[model samples]
Target: MEKTNSASRFVDLVQTKKSFEDIKYWTWSEMLIALKQCQESPSLTNSSIMLKKCIDLLSQKISLADGASSSASSVNSSRFRSSCDSKSTESLKTNFASTTWWFEDLLFFSTECLEMFVQSMVSHEFDQVLLSKFLIHFQKSKFFNATSDVKMKVIESVIDMLDTLDENVLSLKALFDILRVTLGLNINKGSKNRLEAMIGSKLGHATLDNLLVPSPYGANYLYDVNLVLRLFKAFLSGGINQASPSQLAKAANLMDSYMVEVAPDPCLKSSKFLALAKVIPDSARKSYDEMYYAIDLYFEMHVGMSEEEKEKICCALNHKKLSYEVRIHLSKNPKFPLKSTPSSPESQQPETENLLQNINYSKSLISWPHNLTEGINTDEKEDKSSEQIVLYHGKFDLPADNERFKVHLEGMQWRVLELEKLCRKMQTQMRKILKSRVASSYCQVKSLPKLCS
Candidate 1:
C-alpha cells in the first residue's frame, strides 16, 4: 500500500512538470488558443489575466521576428546573398501571416467584450469606473511597434465605434489619434501596392466608400467629411502615384463633392481640380482622352480665378501635352491674364484707339512656320501632310503651354518699335532731299538775274 501511494504521487508530480513545460514553451497557435479561451470566459478578471498573458507572448514573438530580420540583413556574400534573401522573405511572410491572424482574432474578441461591457454598464450591472479604468489600461499598454495589420485593425475598430456610438460618449481626439498613428507608419512600396489593391478592389475589400461613407443632414456629416478628407489627403500625398486609376478617380470625385458643398472657396476648389488633373493616367489613349476631359473641366471651373491661382494652373498645364482638340479649346482661352502694366517696361503698351491695331495677330500668335489660314482650314488635309510628317517625325514635339498671348503681345510691341525707328530714318532722308532741291532752285534764280543784268 505504501509503494502504491508513492507511485501515484510520482505520476502526479510528472504530470505537473509536463504542464509547466508546456506553458513555458507556448507556440503562437497555443497563444492564440489561450486568447480565444479568455474571450469565451465568463469571469472578466480571469479573462483580463488571460488577455495580458497572450499579449505578452505576442509582443515577445514580434520582438523576436524583428530582431531576426534586422540581424539577417548583416550577412553578406554574392553567392549566399540570394539564398539569404529567399529565406528572409519566407520568414517575413510567415511572421506577417501569423501576426495578421492574431490581430484579427484580438479585434473580434475586444469588440465583443466592449459591446457586452457597454450593455452591462447601461443596465447598472457593471461598474462604469472599472470599465473606464480597463479602457485606460488597455490604451496605455505597450504595443512594441506593432505590425500594419494591428494598426489597421485598431483604425477600423475606432471608425466602427465612431459610427455606432453617440458622439457624446466617444473621445473624438482619441479616435483621430488612432488614425494618425496608422498614417504615421512607414509606407513602403509593397504596403502601397496592397493599399492600392484594397482601394481599387471591385469586391469592396477595404474600399474607401465602404470604410468612410459620409453621413447626411447632421453634425455627424461634417465630422465624417473631415475624417474622410484627412484620411484621403494623407493617403494620396504619402503614396503619390501608388494609387490605381479607379482609386484616384474615386478620391477625386469625393474631394470634388466636398469642394462643391462643404468648401466653397474658389482656391480650394481649384486645388481639388488640379489634383484631379494630375492623377488621371495619361499612358493609354482612353486615359489620355479622360485627361483631356479633366483639363477642360478644370479650365471651365477656374474661369474667374485669382492671378496667383491662374498662374499655378498654368504651371500645371505646362507639365503635360494636351490632345489636339484640347489644345484648340485652350487656344480659345489663351493664357492667364497678365497685369495691365507688365513687369518689363519693354512689354508695356501705350493706350491707343485700338491697342492691337498695329499687331499682326495671326503671325504673332501662331508659332507655326506655315500660313495661318492654311493651318486653320481643317478641310485642307492634304496641305498639312508636311506638318503632320514633321510632327510624327519629331515624335510630336508639341509645346504644352499657350504662349500665344505673351508671344503675340511681345511681337506686336517689337514690330511697333521697329516701325517707329524706320519712320524716323525716313523723315531725316526726306528733309535732306527737300534742302538740296531748295538750294538748287535758289542757285538757278540767282544765276538767271545776273545774266539779265
Candidate 2:
C-alpha cells in the first residue's frame, strides 16, 4: 500500500504542469527508473503520459539553459550600452571583467541534461533552434583556451554530435558553424604569427610550404589555393614575393590541369590566370610555357587550323594597318600563304618587302625555342639486362630481341622527343605573336604613318 501511494505521487508529479526547475528535484536516473517501472505495468496509462511529460520538461530545461548561456551579452538599455562602451577596447581585457558566471553554470547544466536525454528511450524530435543556441554558446566560450582536460571534453562532445546528427536543415547550419570555429582557430593570423615568429624568420614560409604539400590538409587544397592566390596577387601588386620557388612550381602544376578544364568563353573573367602568371617562379617558367603550348595545341586540333596557316594568320593579324574584316577574310582562305610568289616585278617589290617582314617575324619566333633548348637535356639512358652476356669475337653482348621490337622502341623514343620539340616550337611562336601584338598596339599609339595606315 505504501509502494502504491509512492507510485501514485510519482504519476501526479509527471501529470502536473511543473516548471523545469521544479522537476530538477528528480534526478534523471530516478526519473528513468520510474518510467521503466510504469512501462512494465499493464494498468499504468497515466504513468506512460507522465513519463513523456518528464522527458519533455528535461529537454526544454537543457535547451533553455544553453540559450541563456551562449548568446552574446545583450545591451538592453542606454545605460548598459554606455557601461560596455566605457570598458577597455581590447577584447581580452573586456571579456575578463565582463564575463558572466551564469554562462558556466548554464553549460554545466546543459551538458548533464544532454547526457541524461540521450540515455532515455523516448523518441524526441531534435530541437534545431535549441541545438543552434547551444553551439553559439559553445563558440562564445572560447573553450580551447581552457585547460587541456576541459578542452578534450568539449572537443569529444562536438565530435560525437557531428557523427550522430542527421545533418538536416537545423544540423547543417550548426555543423558549418562548428567547422568555421575550428578552421578559424587553426588559421588565426594572430595565433600563427606569434608561434611562427618564435620559431624563426622562415616561419611563415614554412607554414605555407606545409599547406602546399599533399596531406590531410591537402583535402582542402582548392580552398588553400584560393586563399594563397589572393595573398599572392596582393603581394605581386605590392611587388613582394609571397611564394617560394617550389610553392610557385606546385601552383603552376595545379594551373596546368585547371586550365584544361576551364571553358574558353572570352566573356568569363580570368583574373586568376593573370595573377598566376605573375606569381610563377622563373624556375617554373617551363611549366607555364608547356601550358601555353597545350592551349595552342587544343586550339589547333579543335579549331581546324594547320600550323603554317596559324603562323600566317598570326603574323597578318599583328600588322597595325590590317583591318579586322580583311584579316578575317584572309584567314578563311585555305592557301593564303604570306610568302606566295608574285606575278610581276612591279608587284613583287612590295610583296618582297612583306615577305622579308614575315621572315623576320618567323625568325623572332625561333628565338624562344633556342632559349628553351639551352637548359634542356634530351639524352636517353642505356638499358642494362640482368641476363649473362655472351662474348662474340671478344665483344660482350646480350641476346637481342626481335628486330621489330627494337624498331618499335626507337620509334616510341623518337615520337616523345618530337612532341617535346613541337611543344617548345609552338610556345616560342605564341610568345612572338603576343609580343608582336603589344608592339603593334604601341605603334598605333605613336601614330606611325606606316603602322597607322
Candidate 2 lDDT tens digits, 211-248: 23221253522333444344334323423255455555
Candidate 2 RMSD to the real structure: 25.6
lDDT of 1 by residue, 1-453 (tens): 644443343334334433322332444444555555556653644456445544544443443443322322233222223333444446545757442322333343465544443343333322233333334334334244756666554444434333333333444344433434545444344433433323332211123233343333344233244344434544555353565655565555544343334333333355654554444233311223344344445545557767777555455443233444454555454433443112322122232213344343322333222222223453464445444434333222224433444456567778767766665675566567657766887978643121111
Off by over 4 Å in 1: 1-108, 111-268, 275-292, 298-304, 334-453
Candidate 1 TM-score to native: 0.29
Model 2 ranges off by over 4 Å: 1-57, 60-105, 109-115, 118-122, 142-145, 170-177, 183-453
Best by TM-score: 1
Candidate 2, number of clashes: 1
In model 2, what are the clashing residue pairs, if there are any? 70-137
lDDT of 2 at 355: 36
Residue-pair clashes per prediction, in order, are 0, 1
